[model samples]
Target: MSDMPPKLAEIVDEFASAPREVVLEMLLEFSDEMPVLPAELRGHEGMEQVPECQTQFFLRAEVQTDQTVTTWFDCPPEAPTTRAFAGILAEGLAGATASEILAVPDDLYNRMGLATAISPLRLRGGTAILGRLKRQVQEQTGTPT
Candidate 1:
């Protein structure tokens, strides 16, 4: 419901020294251990990693219901689309896909003046993946979602 994309951008800016792929990998690893959705619903896992510091993020949402969401994380992009950890969990929000992640222009990195070492994971929830996870729970459970 909020502007989560910009927040994620802030995170990308903060950890400008860690490899964006590494940051994204760590995020997915954590997300899987603690699925953004109900643990009983579905499970999250890392599928693949692409060049340009982009990682493939896959979500098996509604596993019990046969629903799934998969997307990509591009460290740098020409247009720089934004996606917060929270916004990703929003019911209807389709997070980045593998192809989209790979589609990022090679110039994105230089354009953003970001180093390949940028961590991509922000310490604060500026992108707020955790906050988004909590909100997602509330929405799905109807208790806080």
Candidate 2:
């Protein structure tokens, strides 16, 4: 959780302290919190696909003129684990500055204690999600990496 945005660090703290069952439960809870793709971004037109996920995953970010970010994700309900990863991103990164999002460490999931719960392959998907998200923010706002 080092150098994470405040909200994201708080989320990682919760996961880090939770028991295994509680962590998984929190994942589902976050999954439910994930917002639907706004009508404008639906149909996967501008979204980037996360093929690393076993399930279909797509995400995109909008960087406002103020350099704040708004993230979006699309993952079917059936794929709760994958959806939970997107949920974490949607919750953790929303409203962060472009640089804040870009600076998020790639090992965030392991820091959050998710590596012990989810498979390595799934962790790879989560990593990809975060990577693409930061890239999207950087591309939009020209935030220096």
Candidate 3:
């Protein structure tokens, strides 16, 4: 059975606050047809590869939000479903160290911070601001050396 476009539109109306243009545009524009490949008479093949195709709408909406948009755009593929993100300003300056966090380029720092906020269930959450201390510790250093 196929889902009509209007039915999908109804779903979007339900979640009025979400970026509807991005998600709906992606779903409606998706094409289910696959390119036909000739039968191969060779040794056993374990699996057929699925095509990797995603619309630019999601990326465009995210990029357009710009430097002022201090939010994470993507969701983690794995579970522990929900996320909690707070503004960088909201995090407060208490345990933050200037030397480690400030040294990284502004863009990388932003990305790390976003990733951390979006996946607080992961150990790497808001701590992304602490660049060096977050790394895996080595046997010799007992720190992320």
User: Cα miss at 1, model 2 (Å)?
Assistant: 5.1
Task: Give the TM-scores of the predictions, in the order they appear.
Answer: 0.24, 0.94, 0.17
lDDT of 2 at 145: 69
- Model 1 regions more than 4 Å off: 1-4, 17-37, 43-57, 60-115, 118-145
- In the range 1-145, model 2's lDDT, one tens digit per residue, is 4557898889989999999999999999988988988898789998899888899999988898898888889999998988998888888877888878877888989999998898999899899988888888887776676
**Of the candidates numbered 1 and 2, which has the greater lDDT value?**
2
Off by over 4 Å in 2: 1-3
C-alpha lDDT (0 to 100) for residue 52 of candidate 1: 25
Expressed as tens digits, the lDDT of each residue in 1-145 for candidate 3 is 0221232223324333335355333222221111112243122132211111121100001111221111121212222111111122112211323222233232332332333223332323323322221221121123233
TM-score for candidate 3: 0.17
Over 21-80, each residue of candidate 1 has an lDDT whose tens digit, in order, gives: 665554343234332443432333332222222333333222112222232222222212
RMSD, every candidate, angstroms: 13.4, 1.3, 18.2
Candidate models: Cα lDDT each: 0.32, 0.87, 0.24
Best by TM-score: 2
Question: What stretches of model 3 exceed 4 Å from their correct place?
Answer: 1-67, 85-121, 129-145
What is the lDDT, from 0 to 100, of the residue 18 in candidate 1?
53
- Could you give the candidate ranking by lDDT, starting with the highest? 2, 1, 3
